[model samples]
Target: MRVFLLTALTMIAFAANSVLNRMALAGGGIDAASFGSIRLIAGAVMLGVLCALLRGGLTLGGRGRVAGVLALLVYIYGFSAAYTVLDAGLGALILFGVVQITMFAGSLVAREAVPPRRWIGAALAFAGLVWLLWPGAGPRISVVHGLLMAAAGVGWGVYSLAGRRSTDALRGTAANFILAAPLGVLIGLALPTGAAGTVIGAQGVALAILSGAVTSGLGYALWYNVLPRLASSVAAVAQLTVPVIAMAGGMIFLGESLSLQFVAASVLVLGGVAISVLPLQGLISRSSGS
Candidate 1:
């Protein structure tokens, strides 16, 4: 029950990241790149302080640290860039869908055996995602934006896998953010002419800070703490809630409407993921054996 609650809270925080970004960007307060850079810097600072207070200091002198930093960079920039054009709900769907697929792929690559039922469930979830996200017959997504989001998904998957080996979640996340912060800032500076001017004023800065320090930095640490206690399938299935939660956040906070199609798609996707992840047979067998 505690793990379930923590998972729910983590999903809420993850969903809020989209809501906050939409508010900042659509309001003309911040550009995607600038917002991304600010998020990394602020998150780095916040996590650094927390690590210092909690652990007496911070260190990144391990193999996992290097992987975490690289993955963090990919996720931060790719996420920021993808949102420049994608709607909040659509972006969340793509991001989380890709995350599931990437992590599934990672599991295979690592030789972690996946059961047959899990694969079927993943397929159902993917099919539902395609139904939900596929554009109408009128137009298609830009290749560039699609690639960016895909990269972002891969980055986040790598980050999750890297954190799985960590004994200290807070310290590991802090180190990754701190190492990646300068790179994010440098990338922001290197953007084309007039790009930097898009991010403006205090409101934008505040949103970015909240996204970084509260939702992303702290939320990631929480997730890391939870991962070891969860099965790979459970982790994948749990993330299915993020897009639905993000859609709800969009409707409630951003005045976005809940379309019937989207709602239906959500049901199918979430149900399929749940089916794929739950250990129904294991529970039943244990009960019967007992």
Candidate 2:
């Protein structure tokens, strides 16, 4: 129950990230790259401070550290770049779909047993996404934006897989963010300078900080903490909530409208994920074993 709650909270946090980013960017308070850079730096500092206070120090060595940093960079940059052209809800859908597919593929590569019901569930969720995002349905999606979000999804999938092997979730994430922050800044500087000067403001900075420190950094740490106890298939299925939750956040906070197609899609996606993740056989076995 605790794990489930944590997972739910994590998804909400992830959803909040999308809403906050959209709010910041759409409000003309920040450019996408600047937002990404600021977010990474803030999250790194916040997590670093927390680690110092809790652990008395922080350090990362060897291959795991290297991989973590690389994955973090990919996720941060790709995520920021995507928002430049993608609508909030559409971006979330694309990102989550790619993530689901990536993680599901990872499970296969790792030889995790995927049950039939879970496959069906994944299909249903995908069907929902297709319905929601099909051109002329909800929002006009840019191909470039879609591709960038897809890259972000793949990056996050790799990050999640990498984090699963870490012994200390907070320490590892802190290390990754600390290492990735400088690169993020460098990339921000290299991007076309027009958007940087025009878009960013105090409000954007605040939003970026909130996204980095609270939702992303802490949320990711919590997710890593829980990953070891979950199977790959379970993790893949669990991520299904991210898009739906983001959609709701978009509607509530951003005044995004929900159509009948969106509602039906949400049902299909959530239902599919529930079917995929629940351990029905365990319940059956326990009943029969008893």
**Candidate with the greatest lDDT versus the true structure:** 1
- Model 2, 37-92: lDDT tens digits are 99999899888988898889787663467767877778787887777666566678
TM-score of each: 0.85, 0.82
Off by over 4 Å in 2: 1-10, 85-87, 130-139, 193-198, 222-241, 283-290
Worst 10 residues of 2 by lDDT: 132-141
Score candidate 2 by lDDT.
0.78
State the lDDT of candidate 1 residue by residue for 183-282, as single tens digits.
8889877864244575566998999999999998888767877978988767766787788888888888778766667667666666766766678688
